[model samples]
Target: MLHTNARPSDRHRPRGARGFGLAESLVALSLLALLLASGLRGGTALRDRWATAGARDALVALVHEARSRAVERGGAVVVLDASTHVARLESGGDSVRQLRLASEFGVQLDLGARDEVRLVFDAAGVGRMASRSLHLTRGASSARLVVSTYGRVR
Candidate 1:
């Protein structure tokens, strides 16, 4: 007898429910925040991977350039300045290329028990330092670059 003006569907009100309440909204919001946090973590991991890979690739390319320059110019030298974190390419007593490892790629280079490591390539593209191991690191990723005596990279 107390029937108000309510829609037919609203009259039934399945399970006697009105609509979403504050509790339901809070639950949905919490779920969304959890998913967002997980996604951000994945993105951070991906960024670290890219940074590490970029540093490693730059070192490899530097080595290749030094080798080719030696063959073309009869001799080339790469000086790794641990203090400055720079890789300098010298040809004819001039700095042909300089790579700022830390500033450019946010990578750290470890030179074992030395402040400098010099790599010289002869006219025949032969490397003087053999079995020299270099470590490139960024964030949680790391890679080892080794130059063999036979001008081969391992």
Candidate 2:
């Protein structure tokens, strides 16, 4: 069978012997490098996301504890120490509960203007502070925890 549409170069070597050209090889290597770089970036982002989420959960639990204690002890204070990553609940000038966020989540806090944040809850379990914003960071990721005046967390 004579092929009329075949290329002039097709008359040379046997079939099934073709290999990747230089351009194909370079493109493959480039794609592999891109995938590796993205994977590393994704891993760092995942780590930071997990840490920030853990910190947020800890904050909500601490806030709830403070509110509950205030209902029982007249009033309670939740003092967050950014430097040490410790949160303390105080009632009647005595510590009721204390937790270290960094010990578990390895997160850092950024509270504007001060290294501490104090949110007070009254006997009715209502928050005494205005809407407060706290920033939690771990490595390259960050998250916000907004505490409403009614002690609601988001």
Candidate 3:
């Protein structure tokens, strides 16, 4: 008979069974936190960019809708009221449509020298105003909707 100095429990245990130590777990947790922080910052920036794009598209759509309504109704005027942060359509002294801008989008409109900017469209779907630029800004991003003298939106 051979004699060995091993306990009965040790004899039944797997040789290479190991688990993560406290220090290793702490390091992993720290790395995870760092990654989460970076991801959160990136997400915030992406959200802002998305909001800016949405606001710009909304502005373009408003202009196009106003022009279409003018053509359909024989003539129309689109009013961008800064005080209300809304775009309103009027045709033949009757209200057509109103689009309210979301405050979270941070859209700033530069309509030159008017508190309420008006873009007039004739029955021919041509802009009746002189060549003008409408600036739309959100945070650091900006887009310009140019209304040419020929009544074209570029």
The candidate maximizing TM-score is 1
1-154: candidate 1 lDDT, tens digit per residue: 7877888777777756777899999999999999999999888777767776787788788888989999999988889887887888997788999989889878788887888988889998889885677777777877788878755666
lDDT, residue 145, model 2: 93
What TM-score against the true fold does each predicted structure earn? 0.75, 0.69, 0.71
Name the runs in model 2 displaced over 4 angstroms: 1-41
| Candidate 3 structure quality by residue, lDDT tens digits, 49-140 | 77767766776777788788877889888788776667778888898777665464766766777768788988887887778777766666
Residue range with the least summed lDDT across 10 consecutive positions in model 2: 2-11
Candidate 1 overall lDDT versus native: 0.83
Which whole-number lDDT from 0 to 100 does residue 64 have in model 3?
A: 83
Q: Write the per-residue lDDT of candidate 2 for residues 1-154, one digit (tens) a residue.
A: 7658757887686887688999999999999999999899889889889989888888899999889989998999999898988888899899988877778788888887789888999999999898889898888888899999888888
Candidate 1, residue 144: CA error in Å? Answer: 0.7
Ranking by lDDT: 2, 1, 3
lDDT of 1 at 1: 70
Off by over 4 Å in 1: 1-32
Position 53, candidate 1: lDDT = 77
* Candidate 3 deviation (Cα RMSD): 4.3
Q: In model 3, which runs have C-alpha deviations exceeding 4 angstroms?
A: 1-25
